[model samples]
Target: MAAPAPTAIRLHRQRRVLELTWADGRRHEFSCEYLRVFSPSAELRGHGLPEPMLVGGKRDVGIARIEPVGRYAVRLVFDDGHDSGLYSWDVFDELARDEARNWTRYLERLAEVDMSRDRDVVKLAALVGQYKPPQKPGG
Candidate 1:
């Protein structure tokens, strides 16, 4: 598979989804959950010998915030408050290739671990809320 070019990439956040536009003008809608599960950070990738993680409870994952990590990457802050992973050009390229297969394997891994992404997502949100103060009504 040909690797994607960073020069041809653009990312737009919309509520719970991100719309990515390639230089070639092709666009794709990717959710925060999809991006999170596929994060390239060591927390999920584990260095060069990256040990893949089982990301469950992401059926409803949404992007709560976004931080540009540089011209080469973007940190995706999930609604669940997970903002550790930094996605790079290389990693995003890999994600674009046969993403269906990758996602399928993730689901399988979740099952193997007896976990549910959707349910775990709910738990994560709850935990983060415990430490962070409640948001203002219109803030």
Candidate 2:
């Protein structure tokens, strides 16, 4: 059976959600962070390896834009400068269908690596252009 085409696609930046409606009347809402971490790009998926790269510090990432790729996929440009993933119709369907399980697995992997979905503190400091060392008292 052919994959159902998206009848509508909406990116809600305020809510950081991608809303998609399929030709078969199914609707799915995907978080921007979820889509970023699960990007189909080789940078994340790594040549069909058993273990894909773990992406972190994207808790507040948003979709900057979505550009059509041919007639079957979209190139999602993220706020963090990731623009390589091509989200195809079949890929979107699969993501929507497996969101729950995939999310759980992702969270588990994060825990195993002592990582959090929150932005990395070091990166945040760099972005802010300052790193103040902790003060030492009683010199």
Candidate 3:
């Protein structure tokens, strides 16, 4: 019982989002930064390490190209010159399902390390969109 494949895929250049409409009529939109950070490439996956490397400074990353692979995956070429990951249908489904939780965890990890998502600057209080950092015990 394989997961159902996406019926349509659209890249919104202006928004920098990759949108996939699955066969079940569910649509998932992924930001370019999100996709890059979550890429399944061994490079990002850390070559079998217990945890993946924390990718920072991808707030403005964009997908340069998308190439189909056989019948199960697509290779995403990022503007930053990354094109190693082969994203499969299964991976896409899993990502879509866990997007919220995954994003929160990523942000938390960044906060833990005082990392920045900006390309060349590190801001201790730079937050994006509607992400409200967890409050400290006493501010």
Candidate 4:
């Protein structure tokens, strides 16, 4: 099968939904909360590890802004001042396709570890604090 070309992209700031339509007429919707938690960043996921840090208490995350990087990737500036990870088209497509399954697995893992993702800034700072990301190379 050929790769799908993006036909349209929409972001609903109020609803916190990012929608994408492909050339083949397939559409997908992803929530800002999910994107924030599952961000592909070292802060969220450590380097050289597939194990991810569970994120919770993001029942109300909002989309701040979406900036196009190039033809393939986009920089998502979240409302919570997280504007790091660069999401490419393929990565986004995978997230859209397997969102439900991945979320289910994440929840299950959290439950198995007897952990709660529900967290506020006050609570998180107590755990790990004042981390400013170093500049990305060639940026």
Candidate 5:
């Protein structure tokens, strides 16, 4: 069965959070940075790689607008001009369910590559000795 849509969608711009409340009395507050990084857009999700690309440097993003698409999804327009993702109810549910794990994983991935949540800030270690070139296929 498909996931149920949020009964109430509230954007707390001041706090930079997207809150969703469902019929089952479940509520989740997602950070704008979280939603932006985990966006269901092809630019992020459609990367043809086995895993989705890691997105960093969006710690302060806010939702500019939310446009409903039919009964199943909403398109999130970010203040940073990213408006490609269609966030379906299922997507929201999955995000809420896995928020903790996902956030941890995201942070770990960023650290692995010496990436930063702050824009344009690369770790000095990455610039010095931690930089490793991508491996060739099957090498």
Candidate 6:
């Protein structure tokens, strides 16, 4: 069966959610963070997945724009300058349908590696080898 086409798509900036209404009378709301972490771009999914890269520090990322892709998908431009993922209708539907499960898995993966959605945490981890703790004034 053919996938239902999107009848309407709206990005609510204040709420940071992508609201999609389909021809089949289904509506799905996707958070910007969710979309960013699950982007279909090669950078995120990797060329062949030896386990795609774990993305962190996207807690406040926002969709800068959503451009149509040949009536089949959308290219979401993120505020952080990522714009490679092409979210097709089918993929969008799958994301909406499997949101709960997928999000749980993502959290689990993050936990497994001690990573977080906080950018500061990622930066601190990257500086582990170079950062020096500040000395006390009288030490």
Query: All predictions: root-mean-square deviation over Cα?
Result: 11.5, 7.8, 9.3, 9.5, 4.4, 6.9
Scored against the true structure, residue 37 in model 3 reaches a CA lDDT of 90
Q: By TM-score, how accurate is candidate 1?
A: 0.69
Give me candidate 5's TM-score against the actual structure: 0.86
> What tens digits encode model 3's per-residue C-alpha lDDT throughout 11-116?
9988999999976779989999999999999998976676567888999999999999988999999999999999999989888888898899988888776687
CA lDDT of each prediction against the hidden true structure: 0.69, 0.87, 0.86, 0.77, 0.90, 0.86
TM, every model: 0.69, 0.83, 0.82, 0.75, 0.86, 0.82
* Arranged by TM-score, best first: 5, 2, 6, 3, 4, 1
Per-residue lDDT of model 5, residues 43-119, tens digit only: 98875766557888999999999999999999999999999999999999888889899999999988878788995
Clashes of 6: 0
The alpha-carbon lDDT assigned to residue 26 of candidate 3 equals 93
List, residue by residue over 1-139, the lDDT tens digit for candidate 4: 3345477879988898988888778888888888888887778878876766777667687878889887877878888888887777777887887789889988786665455556533445444565677999999
Q: Number of backbone collisions per candidate, in order?
A: 6, 0, 0, 2, 0, 0
Candidate 5 local accuracy as lDDT? Answer: 0.90
RMSD of 1: 11.5
So what's the TM-score on candidate 6? 0.82
Query: Model 3, poorest ten-residue lDDT window?
Result: 120-129
lDDT of 1 by residue, 7-48 (tens): 443345455567666677666666667888887767877766
- Model 6 clash pairs are none
Best by TM-score: 5
Q: Which residue ranges in model 5 land beyond 4 Å of their true spot?
A: 120-139
Q: Which stretches of candidate 2 lie over 4 Å from their true place?
A: 120-139
Error of 1 at 21 (Å): 0.5
Q: What is the alpha-carbon lDDT of model 1 when measured against the actual structure? A: 0.69
Better of 4 and 5 by TM-score: 5
